[model samples]
Every structure is written in C-alpha cells, then in structure tokens.
Target: MTVRSTAPKDTLGEELVRFDGVVKRFRTSLGRRQTALDGFSMTIPRGSVVGLLGPNGSGKTTALKALLGLVRADAGTIRAFGRQLPEGQALVASRMGALIEGPAFTASLSGERNLRLLGELHGVGAETVAEALELVGLTQAARRPYSGYSLGMKQRLGVAGALLAAPELLVLDEPMNGLDPEAVRDMRALFTRLRDERGMTIVVSSHILAEVELVCDRVTIVRHGTVIRDGPVGELLDRGTVHTVVRVEDVTAARSVLERAGLAVTAAVGPQGPELHVGATAADPGPALLKVLAEHGLYPQELRLRQASLEDVYINAIREADAARGATGAAGDVG
Candidate 1:
C-alpha cells in the first residue's frame, strides 16, 4: 500500500530540518527485513512548535532517533541547522537537546547533583543548573534523591536536563506521559515561554491529540511508517466540513425553509426536538447562512456548528491507510 501526503509544498527560506526521501530498515524475526520508515520527507520551520503524532508502531520514534543520530538511516539525506546530519551531527546536536523516552539518572543521586553533572557535560555553569531546575519547577525537589521522586517529578527533571544546555532545538517524546492535568497545563505554558521568550524550536511527539492541538503551531501525522498529513494546525481545522445541528419549533417547516435557501438539511431528532444537520462549505458560512434562515421566519431555538477535530483527522488517516492496504491484499490474491 502506498501512502500519499496531501500537504502542500512548503515555501523556501523557512526550513530548519529537511529530510529528502529518508528511509530506515532493520532485520526482523525469521531474518526478514522490516522497514521502520519509507520515503519520509519533511521540512520543519525554524522556531516552530511541531507536533509529531502517530499511533503505536507508526515509526514516529524511529524518525526522531534518526534525527538525533542514535540510529542511521539506510537511504536519503537529513540536514539540520543547514548541515548534513550524523557527520556535522555532533556540532549540530550540541545545539539541540532531547528527552527521547524518559529521564535516565542514578537512583542514589540527588536531583540537584544529577543536574549538575549534566550541566558540566553541556558546559553549563552552576548558575545555569540552578536556572534549569527553576525553569522546570523542580527547585524544591532538587535536593531529594531521584529514587524518591514521583513519575511526574522524574519527567520534570528530564526536562530540566534537556534545558541545561540551553539548546536552540528541543525534541520531546511524550513529555506529558505521566503528568496530571495541572502539570500538563504547566507544560503547555513552559513550551509557550520557550518559543516566545527564548526563540526555541520544538518538535513534540505525543498521542494526546487535544493537547497537541492546543500547543502546536503545525503538525505532521504519520501512520504505517509514512507521513499522511502535514500542515498548519489552523488550516487543517478550517478544512473540516462544518456540521450544524439546529432545533426549531416546526421541524417540517424548518427543513423546507433551509432547503429553499440552498442549505443542505438532514432530518434527525436531537435532544431538544427534531433538528436539521447542515454541512456548510469549506469557507465561512456565517453571513449567507444566517440571512437565509432569518428570511424564512424559522426561529431556531438552538444552533451549533460541529467540525472534524484533530482526533478526527488522526483516526481518518489511519483508517484510510488500513483500507488501502486491505484493497491491495485483495488485488494480490486476485492476481
């Protein structure tokens, strides 16, 4: 099955990381080859917060690890900070920091000591260590042994380590995994501050669609080891077909009124009463829609617009991929 991306071509002069036809492969059980990534290409803009979303076994982690030089790609070129990766990768990676899975720390070491050791490795001074701890809201727990910290606190300490280098690019994989609701909110604020105040570029990978929608400027979705969608979050949201539910006193009359005005109405009974579902256009439906309804004297008691959400898009992409694969298998059997 082939996955075709619907994303538009990105304009020049905006890319920070560029991958052209990148692929990665490994040996699987029974000595068969498995492809983790296939022709994955993308250009992440500088200083932009991009949400990398995919379901389990979708190769999101493989893509990130390739960027960090932890795994080498079998084909294609990856350029970061205007240089080819894994060669000038050291110099380029120095300007980047990441929390790939979770914090790896000595159980006996105090949080502060662990941070100090990381700071030293990154050439960060003592003052920088203190600042990193404060930035992650881990200053109070800085003196406690890492083994005593909760899962959320351990995640925070990992974030602090990532910040210790004061990197230009930060890559986080499920940074909010163990966080509570309040902590998730706090993490959002921290990401905003990092981009607004410090001018940092962030690539966050998560399965939490709503949180990604709230925080990301743009998103790139992958499924079955291929990129399915990539674009501005707002554009994707706006492209959704608007579905409006309307409740009126006269259900039959309401349908006639809306139909005459060229609005598609479906007769479906809602909680309030029989309602009409309107599938509005891709563009704005406000002025023309309201004028038509008002002209017909069908006073709607309730009117609400529903559209596809980030989760909707995510699910559809994966389902489409599965359907394509099923069709291909059927064709192969026929052949």
Candidate 2:
C-alpha cells in the first residue's frame, strides 16, 4: 500500500527527540533501590529508523517510558520537537505514539472493532482506521476476534493501533517479539515504508540484532543504563575487525601459517571443504596472508573478505563494557 503523508516537511532529517543524562530509579519489593537508567542519553533523527538495542535489564524500556512521560526521571532532560518533556508532553502528545511491552485488547472484540474503539478515543476518523489496518497487512483478518488472533497477528494489530493517529514519531519496544520469519520481513518493509513514504521517525528497541542491522539507519547500544555504542550502522560495522575467509586444501597447515604470522585464525567447513577464517588485526591483511600461505605451499583455492556482522560488534561492545565495569568494581573494593 502506498502510504503518503503531507505533514510539514520543514524539519525532515533533523533531531526530533533527545534524551540527555537521564536517570531513573525504582524501589524493588525488598526495599532495595534499582537503577533502571543512569545517565542514559540518545537522540532520534527525524525521518529515520533508529535502533535502540541492548541486552535484558539494559534500561531500553525504562528510557522509552521516561520519554513517554509514563515515568518521570530523577535527573536529566528530555526534549521532543524542541519542547522540554513532562512540561510539553501534552503539546506533543498528538505527534507521538508508542507500543511498549505488548498491547492489550478486549478478547471478544474483533481486531477491526478494537482499532475503531481506539480511533474514537483519539478523535480519528473511520477511514484512517481502515488505512491503518491495511498498512499493517491485517485487512483480510480484520474481523477475527482478538482471542483467536495469532501472536504475530496481535502484534500487527497493535502496530495498526499505533499508526491509527498517523503519528509523526513512533516508538516500538520489541515489536518483532512473536513474529514469524515472513511477518518479520513484512514488519521490516512496513518500517521502511513509514520512513520513506510517510516521513515518520521511528525508535525500535529489540534484542534481534540482525534484524536491527538490516532495518535501522543508526543504532544505539546501552549497557548498565548508559550508551556504550552509538553511531550509524555502516560506520559502526566498519569500525569492527575485518575477517578474511581462505579456502585451502590443507586447512590445518593454513591455520598454523596464519596464526604464526600474528593473525587470529579459526577453522570451519564451508560448501566446498574446510576453510580458515583469518581475523586480520591489521587493515587489509589479504596480500600478506596470501604471501605467507604460498610460502608454506598451502595456496588458497578461494579467498574472500567479510565484514563484521552486527552481532559480532554487539558482543564485543558488551564484553568490553562488562570488563570495564568489573575493573571499576575491583578498584572500589581496593579503596
């Protein structure tokens, strides 16, 4: 479906949302205080898909809640559309929509009816509701009772509700939680269409790093309630280590040669036969690797370069963050 919006284009690609040094804490049942967010900060560019990614208990959801004004921050500042939050939430309420955790619906009500009810509350028109349903690929199943809808179908309906108001900024937490492969593909396309066709900015928080890598223009990874990595997907990926896969007959010999040459090597079986993966510490270790392999009479049948995946970068970032935290804690104990 062609989704078009005539909303003001003056601020397209500009900073639409900003979270600065935000801090949030909660009191657990045991009377211990938990830091949900500590100096968390991020910015969402207008008309772009930004991925808010982190492991469990990484303050992703808490940051979203604080932005929506569902919870207040003890410190730091948030601004949406250049208006300070909490004070200006009402003014920008009509421009933002969010689906946090999972959405709830009346069991007996049909999906169409549920969305219609939401439209009524938001002063949205019936045609808009229909458009939303079609945009989310739920038109055929729109009449299905909410109780009978599959998990993926329910997620689609929740997304349709978020789109009902034609919001400018959409925040979705774990939107792909229960979607099947096909549904995930459709949702990714929907996000692209929303950004390209409708010119809407999106903030998606999910643990699916691969999906985030495919759909997000920029990624912000948080740990211990603070951002440890934040940049455009391309820039971040390029900053990671380069990998070269060498297909050779003598895999064991090739591994020895590469490792002795100061390269990290691993073995794996590929489509043809055994292959050696060389993690190049230096940039462009291709020529040097080939020379060394030829020197040892272990010529490569085929050699190819591979870029680091988002998952690889994410793992390294988390490990580094954890190691830093561990060292800090040790120093504190020493003190």
Candidate 3:
C-alpha cells in the first residue's frame, strides 16, 4: 500500500517515522485470537531519541517489530523517511538499523568477527566494525569469543552491531538489558552523542523508566496495544502533581490530621521511616498541613514538596488510562 507523508510542516524538521492506527492480531497456541496492536500510533521526529515504554506483554515488542516490517499489521499504515514501508523498506533499508530482543552470533566467533560478518553483509567494512565496537565500549573485549562474553558484554556487542551501518534511524529494544550500572551510564551517553553528533533519530523501547527519562527527549507510554501517554519527557513530568511528603514522629496521627483536614493522604515507610504523602492541591500545602498538625500537638520533623519523577508519571498515566476506559465502559452499559 502507498503511504503518504502526513507529517506537519515545520522548521523543527519532518518526522522520520509514523505508524498510524496500526492494528495487528495473532492466533495463540490455545486457538484464541489476541490483539497485539490496536490502533497504535507514534511519530518519530528527526534527530531525537524517543523512548517507547510499556509493561510486559503490552505490545511494545510487537509495535517495534511491525515498524521494522518483521511482522505485518492487519490494518493501518506505516510510513518512514517520507516513504511507505515494506514497499519502500528496501529503499530505506540502508538508512535504518535495529537490535530487537537480542543479537544472534556464532558462539565460537570473536565479538569483533561477528560484527565484521554482519557489516560485510551490509557493505560495511572492518573500519566501521571497529568504530562501532569502540562506540559501545567493547574494544577491549573485541577479541573474545561470543560464548566467553558476559551478559553485559553480549548486550554491548549487539549495540555495536546495530551501529555497524552508521544508520540514520536506530531502533533498540531494551538496550539497557544485562548492563551494569557503569555500562548503563555509558550507553546513555552514547545515545545522546549519537543524537547530537551523528544527528540520528533513535527509537528505544525499554522497561528502564529512569534511564529513559535521563536519555530520551520524548517518550510514548503504551498499554494494551495502544498509547496511553505520549509527549516530551520534561512536559509530561512538569505537568504532574507536586506531592507534599511529611516525616513526623507520629505517622498515624499526622495521617489522621491531614485526612481530617479534607486533604488526601497516603502513608508509606520511606528511608527516613514512616512518611505521609499529602496531595498538594494548592501552591503550597506545607504551611497548611503544618498548622493542622500543630493544632493536634503533633510536630513534623520535615515537610517537603516533591516533584513527580518519571516513574510517578508513568504509574499515573497507566492509572488514568484505566480509569478512563472504565468510565467509557460504564457509559456504554448505561446507554
């Protein structure tokens, strides 16, 4: 099918990939049909790192596979590089590279040799393979056989393979998997440099929310085969509620006081012991919460407003989507 470019005209730059209302279904071993993608849509802007995040079995891999034409969607369209997919896949194949799930290689071959073989197929040479290995910090382990490498090393090798072609659009699924803390940090920096120095558009799907928040410019959170939330990371986090965290000698008493004052409260055991989180509806709820607690003869050791973290935003988004869906179903039943 011919897919037209529906990207908005802008100085920012045209979107490199667009999956519009895509739908994919599969038959399970139990003879039941399961929907893998339900009207899923996403736009990948040029020179940006977009994080695709979702829970397990939430269609994250399915969507990425569909984008790479590894699987066909029963409906909807996928356009990339101003060209229709599958039909134009060959034309744009050289410009795109991907590492899905993991990389496969001859176990007996050295890491460097595996990359070299992969590069050779794409007309890439030894120099490109070496550079890719170095970029992923795999230079020291390059001569080691694939079977001898650790899990983290294997992950780095996979990343090296994806970069072998110097692709303009790189798609990585769980790129941070099997990486240590230091390797994770290095990978984050590498992704940033690829976007800044190489001007590449990277689409990364990962369960590592904090890393995604740190490295990605934008994020799209999906659930049940559809997008629940999609926007710039900063914008989405900034729009979240600023919660008031209270650490007091009497946790139960503080919670009672806050709840009685018509404030929403949740109690949990933090690093500092029992803590109460009060939803801050006003610009500053600290003073009000403090005053109310004082009246009850309870003193707070600390009360602070905490900005929402990416994890908080993700949880809230999933909850909001579930609530909205429930409401829709309820309305449908009434009608």
Candidate 4:
C-alpha cells in the first residue's frame, strides 16, 4: 500500500469532502451559456459510501471532476482532508485513488505487470502490489495478460490498482458499467468490504439507483446541476412514505377512483399482476384504498402496502425537479 500523505487530518465529525454552492459553466458551440453545475453542494463523510446519482448530464461527473481538480469550479468552496481544494489536492490525492470512466490499462501488459508499472511510478513496492491483488482477489489471475481478462477481471484489476495507495478515499464513477449481474453483485460486495475493513470513505457516481441503494450509506440526486435529494436510503423513503399497490379487476375505473380522491396514482406492474401505485397517507393507506375502490364499485384482486425502493425516491425527485423547472420557465415568460 502507498504511504499516507501528511495532509492535515479532518476534525472529528467533519466530512472527508465538502462542496458548498459550487458552480461551473460552459459555452455551447453556438455560443449559448450552458450551466453544467449550478449551486451544487454535497458532503462525503469519513468511513461512509456516498452515491452521486442522477440521469445523464445531471452534473454527477462535473461534481466529481471538480472535487478531484480535473475541473475548476467558477464559484463556491471545496475541501478535502479539512483543507481547501486544488491547494490540498496534491497532498490529499496522495492518500486517495480514483477510477473515473474507464480505467486505462496497457493491453499488452499482464494484470500484475500493469499494476506494477503504475505502482512503480507511485513508489508502491512488490509487497504492496501483492497485498492489493489479494485484497481484490486477483492474485491467481494476476499474471494473465490484460487483453485476455474478462470485463469483470479488468475491473477487479482497476480496483486493485486503486487499492495501491490503500487510499482513505476511493472515488469511482460508474464502476459497475457493462458488468453482468453476477459481476455487479461481486463488485458491490467488494466495495462493502473495502469500507467495513479498511475504514475507507467512498464516493461513487452512478445513475443506477437500485444498486446505489444497496451499496451506498447515503445518496444525493442531482438535476439541472442542483441537489434534488440527499439522505440515507431509508430516510428518503420513510415508513410514513410507503406506497400501496392495488391490482383491480378494472384498471381504468380503479385508477380514476384513486386519482379522483386526490391521491397520486400511477400505473405499475406488481409482483402478482398489473397494479396501480397509490401514495400512502395517514396511518394506514391500505384500508383507505379499499374503502375508496369499494365506493366506486371497484374491487382490487390484490392490495398491498410496500416500502418505497430507492428507484421510487429517485424517480420522484427527478419528476419534482422537472415540474419545478417547467413552472419556473412558465413564470419567466409571463412577466
């Protein structure tokens, strides 16, 4: 593992990384001003996994790039290791590793050889390389040529390289891209092990909400370069915010009844059959839904209350952002 830099340590309870009111702007080819990051702010705590989530172009990459000094923010404050960014970037980066987009590996080199070549540049020794390989469980195949390795194996090697520094913080953007289901599951477990065993703080950027929910301690959803939602998975979808799915004999009639009652209704497919998602209200929404459907001469073949998934929370956040944008755009035209 690489030696930790002597950068000033963070005070207790202070986040490992913090961005406050960060802004970044770009100009389109046609000379129009395009804001990629606008008032974007987020924090990553020590010994935690934080996911940067949003649809494509929601500024997830821009945020990460700004933190790593790959891109400069036009305004706002950023910190790493309790010190300001860019200035602290050199020292702090010495104690962190990242796999942004796709890692670059020499196709001609073996997995272990590639890591060794890169590690040598960073002063990482053979022992550390072996340990990193073991950590990522790439020891047996380490000698295999990089070109022959499967996508998952290549990814594991990338992680092994990132582990070279035994970094206190690991920043990965869409690390799970192009992996099969099994590989995805394996990678998720690997990231968890890194945090629980190494006390490493991780900041991952991804649009895959379901996996993010499973892997991240907290999630931040961004839209139009602004944070739309940020919280632990359960907190965003609290017990009070559960959804009820109702599959009725008449989909149209049941949907109309639910919507007419002032509750949000969305057509969905439940585990058992076609269903409608009804937002929960009060103590128990299941009973109330049944009562309403009965009043409308509609009965559901199946009715159940389900906890909201991370995808549900993400979708709601984006939808709300879209509505807000629409309203603001309309208001701008009116006056």
TM-scores vs. true structure, each candidate: 0.79, 0.88, 0.92, 0.89
Ranking by TM-score: 3, 4, 2, 1
Worst 10 residues of 3 by lDDT: 1-10
- In TM-score terms, candidate 4 sits at 0.89
lDDT of 3 by residue, 1-335 (tens): 01123223352345889999988888877776788888899998887899999877778898888888898888999998889977898898878889998888899999999998998797878888888888999989899899999888898899888887778889998989999999999999999988876677899998888999999999999877888889999999998778999999989888888888899998877897889888998888888888899999998999999998899899888888778768776211100
Best by lDDT: 2
Per model, state how many residue pairs clash: 0, 0, 0, 0
Q: Show the colliding residue pairs in model 3.
A: none
Candidate 4 residue lDDT tens string, 86-140: 7788878877788876778999899899999988877888999988888766789
lDDT by residue for model 2 over 1-335, one digit each (tens)? 22336346777768989999998888877776788788888899899899998888888899998888899999999999899999999999888888988889999999999999999988877788889999888999999899999998998899999887778899998999899999899999999998888888999998888899999999999988889999999999999877898998878878888888887887877788788778875667778888998998888888888888898799889999889989887211100
Model 1 spans with C-alpha error above 4 angstroms: 1-13, 245-303, 330-335
lDDT of 4 at 2: 49
RMSD of each: 8.1, 3.8, 5.2, 3.9
Instruction: Mark the regions of model 4 whose C-alpha exceeds 4 Å error after superposition.
Output: 1-13, 295-297, 330-335
